[model samples]
Target: MPRLMILFTILLTVGAYLLSKALYLRYRHPLLNIVLLGAALVIATLLALNIPYQAYLPGRRIMTSLLGPATVGLAVPLYRQRSLVRRHAPAIVAGVGLGSLASMLVAGLIALMAGLPREVVLSVLPKSVTIPFAVEIARIHGGSPGLASAFVVATGTLGSVFGATLLTWAGIRHPVARGLALGTGAHGQGTAMAFMEGEREGSMAGLAMTLAGITTATLAPLMVRLLLRS
Candidate 1:
């Protein structure tokens, strides 16, 4: 019965994504973001079915395992732009470093100021990165891993939906700048959107996303310790 339940969960998740993709293609609207729509559909279905999240954990874990391979796949785009990427290596590092650090600091400070617990600050601190890593950071900080994952998904979805428009409004017409902004702020979903803009944008975004995640993972704990006075 548990295996059957897991199968059902997987099917529901995939079906929701497919439907959401179709809707996105037909409407071509940002709000039709498949991530947001698919998540909502999955959550709603779980609710309607009275299925506990834990009941779907097996299928979810199976899905989560793919994140590593998917992340590795990002290297393909980067490799394609090696010469161009090397030319701007320093700038790329600077942009990603600043953007990623700024996001963590602002979010962490705000969470602290709001009188939220130290653990809560930790969780939000890693929200700018991918979820699997975010969960680990949240655990180290005594945060709710679930909330950390939720925040990651929300950040990615929001970034993907608004990143391009926001960059254009900010007068950042350069593909590199836009890609850095999206990947640093949004992670994988943002990278996917960057790919839509151009191969160069996608490549840069992939690099930014990889760098930001590693930077966040390495620096977050030290910053947390210092911020919390421990």
Candidate 2:
């Protein structure tokens, strides 16, 4: 990639995020989502500039790599919430396991109902998990990583944008329950929102996210094999 193209990618990505953050702060609306807005701005800029995605891949990869450390950072708050986690270990395990299994099964069933191709079904199977784990799950099941990543983003974004409102409507106000639900459904974005709720919420959300990822990674391939067998 040209040096100029790399610079463009970095500037565009960071600039779009900053702009979206400012707007979100002003509006305080779920629709003012930074990810959705930043993605649109970045894509529009690249398209208008006639820059291909390949030119932005390096910068995008750098951004993607940051997720690893961000995920690790969740341990700090989780350490603070250790007693809470210990008290609720059984509930947490059941909640995460059920959430992970239900998500994969539902995705697979939807793909089947829609008569999508086998690879497409496999790709969608991991959509509820975080991107890195989802991509690997898709690859392990002979699916497309690009599709897996896209679906993961869509799932997380939708969940993050409206999940709290839905929880409120249902009268689910317990922080641990809310955190687990959000984390299981939305992954990183949900965890971020949970942190905004409070440290205990964030800790539970982080734990739920990790548990869901591991469960999805282990079960997605098995589910695909079962689908094939059926």
**What Cα-based lDDT does every candidate model obtain?**
0.84, 0.84
Task: List the pairs of residues colliding in candidate 2.
Answer: none
lDDT of 2 at 18: 96
Q: Candidate 1: minimum summed lDDT over ten consecutive residues — where?
A: 28-37
Candidate 1 per-residue lDDT over residues 1-230, each given as its tens digit: 99999899999999999999999889876557676788889999999989999998999999778876776775686687788768888878899889878888889888898999876787899998877678877887788887897788788888988888999998999988888888889987898899899987887888888788878888887778767875
TM-score of each: 0.84, 0.81
- Candidate 2 per-residue lDDT, tens place, 1-230, comes to 37777777988899999999999899876556676788889989889989888888988887778776776675675676778779989879898999999998888998989999988888999888887788878988789988898888888878888887898899989998999988998898888788889977787888888779888888776888777666
Q: Whole-model lDDT for model 1 versus the true structure?
A: 0.84
In candidate 2, which residue ranges exceed 4 Å CA deviation?
A: 165-174, 192-202
Off by over 4 Å in 1: 160-162, 192-198
List clash counts for every candidate, in order: 0, 0
RMSD of 2: 2.9
